[model samples]
Target: MSPKILVVLSSHDKLGDTGKQTGWYLPEFAHPYYKLEGKADMTIISPKGGAAPLDPSSVEMFKEDAEASKFLKEKEALWTNTDKLSNYLGKADQYDGIFYVGGHGPMFDLATDSDSQQLIKEFYEAGKVTSAVCHGPAAFVNVKLSDGSYLVKDQEITAFTNTEEDQVGLSSAMPFMLETKLQENGAKIVKADQPWGVKVVQSGKGGKLITGQNPASAAGIGEAILAAL
Candidate 1:
């Protein structure tokens, strides 16, 4: 049987009162979804249960990207009609793994959502794959395992870096710095050599905790997830 993966997206659309619309980054989800499509069956879900917002900037920036464009047109319903994350909380057995696609939005919602945290904990403790990219790792910031240790605790990981956040000039707008929070949670975080460079870290029990540095690492994160699975 094909691996069944649950793809989680952020429901928050507002970008920290910056008056900018933000949601999941297009390429971050787009690239990985396609990479894992034939290999794994996926179900998309979010906190709000519908229309996982797409960051406008990511849409505009990738206007010419064939993969992103194709995904938006062909798989629009997958994102726009996401189911409720809460519905899957105790149903981790249905999925082989869970994946998070990053945008500034996850920093606002998924990071603190109790349901999201619980689901991650269930997956992690069950020895299942748990992965994220860019701001997606924000969801890991507050996910404590059964022993009260943060899920990222003592794990090697990577996410949108503090420098990249500042470079993009939205550091102050975020509720907290993602990379810093992950580090504070005891994750030995690493990053790419340069901003926007592709970097994916797979560490934790059985290397099932996979994370990517930025949008550039989306496909790599998917590849890592497949390897871990």
Candidate 2:
């Protein structure tokens, strides 16, 4: 069987109280989708189901990238047909792995959704390739493993760093810094020297959890996940 990969996206469109719009970052999803589409069967899911919103700035930023353009033009159905996270909470065994795509949106919903938390834990316990990129790791902030330990505890992982969050100017609006929360959860954070530089980490525990630092690391994360599979 071609491995089935579940791609979870954030459904929250508003970025905290900033009155700014945000959702799944286009390149974060587009880059990985292009990388894994032919090699795996991918399913899209979100908190509310239906069409997940797009981060407007990301759409404009990658407007000219050929792969992104192709994805925008050809994958409209995937955007409209997402399954609700609730629908798959106990079905993690059906998937070979889970990929969380990030934008500012994940910070609002995926970080706290109990269903998403449970699904992530299930995937982790199954010894599957569980992965996330950028703010996508927000989903990992509260996940507890079967042994009642925080999944990220002592794991070598990377996500949108505090410096990158400040550079983006969303720090004040966000509930808390992602890197800090991950650290509080006991993850040993790793980061790239420069913002937008590529950084991907395989969890200290036998490389089951794969993470990427930022949007620029999306394609690399996809490659790593495929290799893990």
Candidate 3:
């Protein structure tokens, strides 16, 4: 049987403020969804049960990209009816891996939610690949392993960087910076040329934990996860 993977999305709706443009970027989720959907039995879930928000800017960009445009119009059901994370936490062992999709929104909720932290721990301890991209790595900030250590500590990984955060003008708006926090916790951080550059890092003999720099790296990240599986 093909492996099953759980794709967790951010539930945050506002960006900086309620009226501003911020949420999950369309391409980030679409590219990976396309790559993994058929090859793996994939299930999309969110911190909240329904209606995952889209960053307005991403929606505009998608309108211009044919693939993304098609996804937006045809995958309406996925966006409108995401499974709640709470419902899946009890059944995490059913999946082969867990992937956290990125957006500024994850920084707002994924990092601190107790349920999210627990899910990460459960998946990691079960020997499943636990992967994330961009600010999605923020969710790892508080995930504790069976030994009581942060799951990411001393692991070589990459995420949306501090410099990129400033370039995007979100450095001041985020609850906390991802790169800084990851380093402070003992991760040996690796990065690519620019904030928007596509990059991915995998660590462990089985390549069990994976991370990507940003949305541009989502496809590569998905490939890595599939390979590991």
Predicted candidate 1 versus true structure: per-residue lDDT over 112-145, tens digit per residue:
9999999999999888999999999999999998
**Which residue pairs show backbone clashes in model 2?**
none
- Give the whole-model CA lDDT for all candidates, comma-separated: 0.93, 0.91, 0.85
Task: Give TM per candidate.
Answer: 0.98, 0.97, 0.95
Could you say which candidate leads in lDDT?
1
Candidate closest to the true structure, highest TM-score: 1
Which TM-score value belongs to model 3?
0.95
Which tens-of-lDDT digit does each residue in 173-199 have in candidate 2?
A: 898899999999999999998877999
Off by over 4 Å in 3: none
> How well is each residue in 1-229 modelled by candidate 3, as lDDT tens digits?
9999988888897776546757677877888778787799888888886988887787886677766787888997886789999887757689999998888988898989899899988888888999999888999987888898888888998999999889888788888899999998878899987668889999843779999998789889989888888
Off by over 4 Å in 1: none
Ranking by TM-score: 1, 2, 3
- In model 3, the worst 10-residue window by lDDT is 14-23
